[model samples]
Target: MINNKKYLVSFMLLVASVFTSNGQDDMDKFVSNLLQKMTLEEKLGQINLSSGNTGAVLGGGGEGQLIAIKKGEIGATGGSSFESIKKIQDAAMESRLKIPVLIGLDVIHGYKTIFPIPLALSCSWDTDLIERSAQIAAKEASASGVCWTYSPMVDIARDPRWGRVSEGSGEDPWWGSQVAKAMVRGYQGGDLSKNNTIMACVKHFALYGASEAGRDYNTVDMSHLSMFNGYMEPYKAAFDEGAGSAMSSFNLVDGIPATGNKWLMTDVLRDRWGFDGFVVTDYTSINEMAYHGLGDLKTVSALALKAGIDMDMQGLGFIGTLKESLDDGLVSMEQIDQACRRVLEAKFKLGLFEDPYRYLDENRLKNEVLTDENLEAARELAARSMVLLKNENNILPLNKKGKIAVVGPLAEATGDLLGAWVMYRNRDIVPSIVEGIKSVGGDDVEVLSAIGANLTNEPNLRKSLSSPFAMFMGEKMVVDERSLEVLIDEAIAVSADADVIVAVLGESTAMSGEASSRADISIPESQRNLLKVLLKTGKPVVLVLLNGRPLTIEWESENVPAILEAWAPGTAGGNAIADVLFGGYNPSGKLTMTFPRSVGQIPIYYNHQNTGRPFDENNKFTSKYLDISNEPVYPFGYGLSYTSFEYSDVEINKSKLNGNDKLIAKVTLTNTGDRAGEEVVQLYISDPVASISRPVKELKNYKKIMLQPGEKKEIVFEITPDDLKFYNSELIYDWEPGEFSIQIGTNSQDVKTASFVWEK
Candidate 1:
């Protein structure tokens, strides 16, 4: 068996080399020769993009695609399939030079076995956990025959309204950069040429985060210093860790769309940051330039080519019209050659050149695809990402010796638990919250549960706009599989007599991601009405909200005793949730994004710049909103625990330094409550003044510490120059000579502050 395995490896290597060898010793040699043999049209063909017969949000995958690929007219394909992958391989074989087609997918969270959204992962503040999550995602994705994933959306999102913020690492670049590296390492692993490792594409290449008004594909403007100092770190970090590709964002960075901004794509991403990967335009980003008034497709394609976009993702113009532009002298052959070479290099790194059919092997494919192990991993991640929002009077760690009423839309939802971007997880495999509760509760706890309502109250949201919800879920637009009013009344009655009401509420899978953006982020009115009935029962209630984005739950927070913000935990989510509820794991998650008081306070953030009209909660006007307070309902880095902790004795090893010194900042934290719990000791920096207006405070460091009852320890963070600088108004990043505040605390809003002066 060992000898056979060795022989298989040898055979694979030999097969890989012939295609990977660039037909010569050096990759550049192979690329130059290949480019030389290519026609102007074929070179132009290298820049075209096409959709697969299936998997597009707008359309589904086909043989026509195979025909296009075989003619060497197609370069890249998005929304491909296992069958499509095989067909593309056959087509590539028919091409004169036999170059493999690079298949890409929006394997955002997971291709098959999904994990929590990136925002949820950030809440963990655990890099190892985040990496492991990505590793699991990669394993399942590669198993499904996907070569590349447009993931690890590293754009630092401060405004939750951006909708795509659900796809990012939140507002802290320090933490964001850490997650960026973790995700890149997890996706690519130590090997990119290996089967389990899919190429990780770091996305929205430039400043897609600072979008105007938190709108998708919105205009973005920021100083170079601000970009370099904060927003660009994650992209740069991914590049440093060897990301396989980059997706240029649709937003205009400064004044130019990142897809056509030569300075951003070439000067910064490649020349300055030294990233060697190819750049692809975001979905239809190239074609949208006409909307931006960038002339015709011919002019824009030339601009994009010059800007460094190699492959066009779903941009029909690049693939359909680049040839005309080439002949029109709009874009040069050498530029086409460079773009094609980059794409070819990416294919080489993926080890597709060696044996393109390696991933297509049916025997191995059957063995590795969505194994029980991967599902188990997803279940574990789901559990860990669940953050206990509130636990008043120790309402959680539910007693196994009581009548437990598990009530709401998500309690018995097997499909909803997997959440969004979970295109491949088998729903039946996931045990619902009730199943999880019953599994662990055993004969000890009497469990009664009811689906109080659908995820929303609006007939338009659940059913159809014009139709009544009577025939919904069976005929018209489905309103979940349960009866809403019947379920709610039953749940209220059940909870009226129960010892505890574990009211599971919040969004179903269709609620908060991508185009699922909400103007009003709150628990559904149907569920909220159900909550009112349950709360009236006067039994201690535990609210388990299954949502994607941070929601407004001030009423629940102030009224309900316990709230668990389980942001659509994946398969086994119910089980993990049960475990946390029964004290299996003390919830340690902190919010990466703030929960505002209302949608009116949409842009609220902890790291926000102090405006000229700053409001002190004491005042009514200025920066404060009259109807609602300026403060976030729940601040970023805020999460409650069953046990309590105390922070004290902050000490700095050195107050001042002339050089790049490792200044140690320490704080003593004690588990003051009886039960042992974990704490995220957040460290933030405040630049009193800068060449540009800067955020009042920025996250610089953090440590998640676990302590037994009465245990105390000091966590020390080494301060560095990198943490002190920001991109100035002039686009230069350097720390100004001024007093800086180093604050350490349990949450972003409440912190212990100290002053230190930086002198040159």
Candidate 2:
């Protein structure tokens, strides 16, 4: 058996060597040869990323695109289907050099069999699950001829008001970095030459989540220390995981647009971080730079090329004006060659040079897309992504034999279950909440449903909230024409005979994605009124929220018997929710972002620097809110389980340590309840004194473990001086030797602490 295993490994190595002979040296020589034969027009075309005529939001180019492909005037195209992409590849085969075009797509969460949004997935704290989901998405996408995906958005979002928060991993930079690395590994795998893998594009290159006023595409400004410590870790982590591509954000960095910022793209990303991948602009960002107070198309295109941008997506600036800029001495050929070479290098790595049609297999598309196995995996992930915010008196893991009443605007919602950035999903196949309850409840269980209210009271607001891409995707927000009074009356009548009411209420799919930021992050008036009336009926209510971001649910937190944060669980969402509700599965998810008590606390987060005068109840001059407490409604790393768990005091192996010593911390965790449950044991570090101010505590490590009732286990973590290091005021990364606090807990707010000292 050992000899056979060794032979298998040798065979695999031989296959890889055969495919990539001399590796990087071979890739360099091949691209260099191609660059010599290409004219100036062809070189510019190598950096031109056109859009397909697939009715996508950023789609363009119909017959003209085919002509350009034949003339070797296009390097890549996004948003194209299998048939269209095959047609585009055929056109490329007719070009002078017969260079095939790279196919790209959004494929954010999933391609066909969708999973929960990235924010919700992060709550699971299961890197293995997240990685498997990405692998499935890559399989489905590669089968459909997509070799590149602009995904794994690693922006660390602190403000829940930022609509794009749904697309990121959440507020903590350390945890978000873990998610970023997992996603990159999942998408790219160990071998890019395989047809099943797709190149991962870690995006919005710089700090895009810190937009002013939590508005999308707004200007971002902050100190260098804050930038390095708070927002930049995840992006760097993704790149370090061997991500092959990146997308420039649609915001300004250092007073210049990211598409043309030399310091950002060239100095920081390329020189400092040593990112060797190609960089692409986000949806005509170069053209939009003109609106950002930069020069016209010609000037911005030249600037972007010199700033290390390799590809222009949906922007004709490069192919249309680079030659003019070259002739006018505005840009040099060397810079253009560098960009073109990187693009070609990516193609060679994808094995496109060996076989352009490697990923366009019809059989794989027929058997792999939306398979039963993939859907089952999606269902399990969606269940794990659900965070049980509150479960007073153990109201969840509901019995399947009771009469279940499902009510709300989203009770029977089909399309909304898939959430945002799902371009290739089959909404008709998605089972609604009512359907799921009925199917999972069985013959003895009785199920009832009603539309309690409209998504919003105003027709104009509903229409305005619809996604712009809905027109092309055959999607529209369905608003009932009946009056709110009539809807509530019907809802009340339906729930009167039920044993329990499950209110599936929250924002529609259009309410929380790009450009959908809201000033009031609370339940809508229409839905809130319905919920109040239902509560008056004296029936037990379980609030199942479907929002993308953390909402201000202070009222519901106080009134609702139980609450579940089910953030737009994807295609199998309903089935997954039912699985958790009926005790088929145990929910073990935790909140990745902090839930503020009110919208006024826009920037509330767990790891925040202390103010000169910290908040105090007795000190009138201290930093405090007069109307409310300074604490959040639900703190970060917070969540509930069906069974309870207790933590013992933290134990340290030593109270003092030297420069190279390792401090060992241990905690005894016991399941104190009557059922089995999973718990996320989090570890945090705090420095009492530093060269500059530091956050109160920063998450350093974590472990998710499952414990049966009455089980007791010791959790241990080894800390080195490296874990205590941070970027200082002078931008130097190091640690200050001093007294430090080590904390271990179920969540950030509730923890047992121990102190240790380290000397340099």
Candidate 3:
């Protein structure tokens, strides 16, 4: 009977493989036929991506964009409204070939129904939830007539100083790789041809996250071994999961702009990793190559074409100069056709040839965008994204009956809750923290609210930052001309009668994202002054932080009774915060990035390589800091729950692991506290000896499990030689024979460890 079942399963698998092969064959035939009949100018048009004059307009020559579309001089356009996108598609239909333009947008965290920022979402440690969030975003975006998303920015970021870190997964390459796969699956779904699914673009192709000094668009110089071992995993994972497109980073790889780096875009992405996706340059990246001293516009355009970049996004380099380069023999007709074919192939896979209006259902747009179901999902995700940084004496789960004063500038503001790279049109739907407290308190708790200070006291800085995104629908940072004493007096008056205070503070919407890096990532002085006074009110304070990146909150950690890393919780952020505060949900989110005690520890992270002289707190001659301790204020994967858990020391099945042999490591976990809650059981492996220096600890696997109060469960993880593998000095991916430590615990720093030996 077992043999018959196996035979039947094998038969089914064979049939599925044949089906997939037939589909690929069909796609190849269609793309081949389409490429043959295309003119040189028309083919150049296929590789040109222009931004429509509507949302976040960046490039010039917008006046002729419509005419360009009608003449088949444009293939794709991004950052435009649905109405405008349809007009471009209509113009494209007027061309001789009637090719539909692929619509792209920065649907990063969400579309209309925004969720927590990507950094916050990573803290959930739940790939399923992350995938669901992406699926919802794709549904909303597709309904709104967008066929592609420049999202799943899977760049692995370790430094909090990098503003774009908010858009990626956390520090560890393994964790980032998981997020990359989940996001790709979510955006594309089971099939790309479906109306609700949009093509996923894995971005910043070659290490934008590792920018020098954590500055965006800075140069990155690293060994090939370092690249393969640490930084390149997420992009490769995204490609493995079938991401349809890739975006070149703004930084240089090996001293050459990635937009013109042939070895990176072609050799690594295509030849090495087998990524069959089309590549697009970041906004005018091709044009910026001139500034990089690579060449003139035409020279850079030709270089970019040969670098395996299929489309020039907003650069106009391909459209403006590729023809001239082609005549000059700098670019060949075959190269242009190859680039054009890839773009057309992507459009063909999206089923745009059959139905250009697949994602243009007016009914879906009305019924689907920001629906209650989507909003509820966002709320649930936001709640899960919240990391309980500190909960001294269980100050949270505040009794719903008390007088709760919601203070701080962010308390009543809805616009700033949605982080950077968000759908700008969804500001009105966001509920303020005050509204959330009231809605959830429901007459049980008297929720007093006050804006204690402006988001920033610097009026000129706020205005300068606000002007860029003023075109989008949302509230900007409003500088109060009133005296600081007046704002504080008003806040103190409101909180004077309150039993407890919930202080909502942190970066405004303009703070940590894409060109908004800060040397000191801390609570602003204006808000800190308010917080210092609030503590004097003799009330238990809960610091609810809303920022894009991990902040240095050493003072708050030591003084505040409770603190929550809310991140920019998005449209449903307020209600989510209320739910967690009132014990409706227990926070299971963990920090994906390390929180340092001071700005001096700028590039701190969990999986860092130990120096020749490791930090010794007692030894001044060691690698310890002069003022602050070497440890992070809060380590990666650290979080608190309403309940407490105790873990037993790791038990290994065997002390030795051989090639292809799986070793079992078990840990007995018990819910020792009063309330039932969930915990993320993380697994880390330490390679004390390797071909080259390795990180002290590296995350290999993790599982999020729920347990009833006083209940005990045994968790087991399978370890193999593959998990211990890393790129050696020679850039070879292999594992060396060594003694390794296996750790099982709640976070990276605190773990129960056991040693084992791996033999070749």
Candidate 4:
């Protein structure tokens, strides 16, 4: 048995070595051969990424652009449709070198058949499902003629005030890295040459999520140790999983714009991490460097190229000013060639060089996109993405036998269901909350809905919310202009005739993505008024929140008997919510981000460092808030299932460990409630003493499992010294020989623990 195990290990090692050696050799050979034959003009064109109108909120390119493509003046485009991409590729075929154009898009969550937003999807704690969503997105997108997707934004976001928090996996670097790897594998598949797969691009290169005050495109300043410890894990994870491309962020990394930051782009990414993928700038980011006080377009463009940016997305800086910069001795020919080679290498790896029309199948487009099978998957995923925040007295798993009154501006909202970065027409096809309730509840349950209030009561505020970028934000919710009292009265009237009320309330889709940060992360005043009136009617109220970021819902949590965070669940959102509400599906999703009681706890997260003086209600000198406690409304990994789970004390296989040693931590979990359900078993490690102060507890591993009522299951996790390593004060990545705590829990705060020692 020992000999057989050794043989199996040897075989796997040999296979991995061969895969790496051959893949790199083939890619380098193809790119080199292509580069040798290319002219200066063609080389520059390969580093140019312009945009085309796919009816989304980016640039538009037409026949004039097609002529440029034929001249080998364009390399890639975003937001272009299949028909348009075919035209662009056809134009490229007429070029001297016939290099195919790569079609890309911000296929964030889902392509046509939209799923839950990224933030909500992470709540499932199901990497397999997240990967499946990415795989389906790739299939749908590739069918539509796109070969690349700008997604899996794995930024570790702690501040909910950042609107783009909706686009990421939440605040824990360890968990976020896992999600990142899953997304990359899902998009690129095992082989990039597959006709159904698309290339994955890890985005916003550095700490764009930690923008000051949670504002988009703001300055980011953090220590090197902090960067390595916290923000850099997801990008590294994606690269390790073989993502083909990266996008430079809009923010400055230590005072220099990321587009022109050499230490970041070259030293950290290329040299240290050994990333061979091409780097592209976010929309006009290279050009925006001028506004960042870097220099003129030409100077900043030259800096970006020198800093290792391979392509300029929506910024014609490379094509327009690179040659001039070259002649001026501001950039070298070798640097230009290197950038161009990387871009061409991506095309080669995508199999576009061999067959330009590989992804342009009309039959696949017809059969694959928005199919019933895909929508069903979307519905199932959306159902899993929902986190049940509060279920007082078992108020949820609601019976479908009663009349359900759905009230709020978002209750009947169709467009908002398909969150940001989606086609405008998707809203027309999605089922509204009321429609979903009706569909799932069937003939027995009567579902009635009313737009209880406008998204906001103030007229001027509604106007301010309007966005010129219509495709990205969608048209602002139209105000009723009727008196607030009248809207509340109608809501009350609807609830009076129903056995139960579902108050669908929260931000509109536009209010929680990109540049849409909110200072007050709560139910809007108008919706709060509507909810209060509904509560007064003596009906059992269920607060169904359809939002992007984590909201401060203290009032709702206290007053409402049940609260469900639906989180802009996509095309089949209504149906998914219906399934959960009507007891067809049990809620298993956990909170990836912390839910604060108030916005004052802006940057609160579970893996926070301990203060010199820890919080103490008894001591006035400690880090305690006089007005409120330091606890969050709902801690990270917190969620409620229809059935409850009980955890046993953590048992460790070893009390001491040395080099290459494995420690097994085990715990017994039992479903103590009446029904069968799923739970996320989380394992966290704590370094009580280290060179630098570490977080109170860092999540190391997690598992999602199902159990029948009264059934017990044993959960085991293998731990190693490598898991104890962190970036220290000197920025050294290594573990210290010390005592550590192994915590096993359903959530971060509630845990059972055991201790062990490690010697170097």
Candidates in order, TM-scores: namely 0.92, 0.96, 0.95, 0.95
Instruction: Rank all candidate structures by their lDDT, best first, as comma-separated numbers.
Output: 2, 4, 3, 1
- The candidate scoring highest on TM-score is 2
| Greater-TM-score candidate between 1 and 4 | 4
Off by over 4 Å in 4: 1-26, 51-61
Q: lDDT of each prediction vs. the true structure?
A: 0.76, 0.88, 0.86, 0.87
The best candidate in terms of lDDT: 2
What TM-score number comes out for model 3? Answer: 0.95
- Which lDDT tens digits does candidate 4 get at residues 1-760? 0022433343344233323332678667666766787888889888888742222233244777777778887888764577777777777777877787888888889889898999989998999999999999999989867889998798888899899999999999999999999999889999898889999999889999999898888888888877889899999999999999999999999899999999999999999999999999998999999999999999999999999999998778998899999999999999999999888788878877666778888888899999998999899999999999889988787787878899999988888888877752466789999999998998889887788888986655576566465345744666777887788788888888899999999988888888787888888898898888888898889999999999998878888999999998999999999999987899999999999999898889999889999987778999978787799999999999999899999999999888778999999999999998999999999999888889999999998999999999999999988899998887778999989998999899999999999888
* Residue 145 C-alpha lDDT in model 4: 74
TM-score for predicted model 4 compared with the true structure: 0.95
Model 3 C-alpha lDDT per residue in residues 1-760, reported as the tens digit of each score: 0022433343344233322332778667767766776788888888888753233343222546777777887898874566776667666666767777888989999998998989889999999999999999999889867899999898877788888889988888999999999999999998999999999999998888889888878888887877888899999999999999999999889999999999999988988889898999999999999998998988999999998889998878898898899889998888898898899889878977656777777788888888999999999999999999899988988897979999999998788888887755566778899999999988888988888888776555567457756335234667667888889999999999999999999987778788777776888888998999999999889999999898889998999999988999999999999999998999899999899898788778888888998877777778987788888899999999999999998999999877777889999999998888999999999999877889999999999999999999999999988898888887778889879998999999999999988888
Please estimate how well model 1 matches the true structure, expressed as its whole-model Cα lDDT. Answer: 0.76
Between candidates 1 and 4, the one scoring higher on lDDT is 4
List runs of model 3 lying over 4 Å from the truth.
1-22, 51-63, 470-475
lDDT (Cα, tens digit) per residue for candidate 1, span 192-304: 87878889989888778777777667788876666777688888888898898999988887678789999999988888889888988888899888888887876887789
Q: What are the runs in model 1 whose C-alpha is more than 4 Å off?
A: 1-25, 52-61, 79-81, 222-226, 361-364, 463-477, 480-485, 617-621
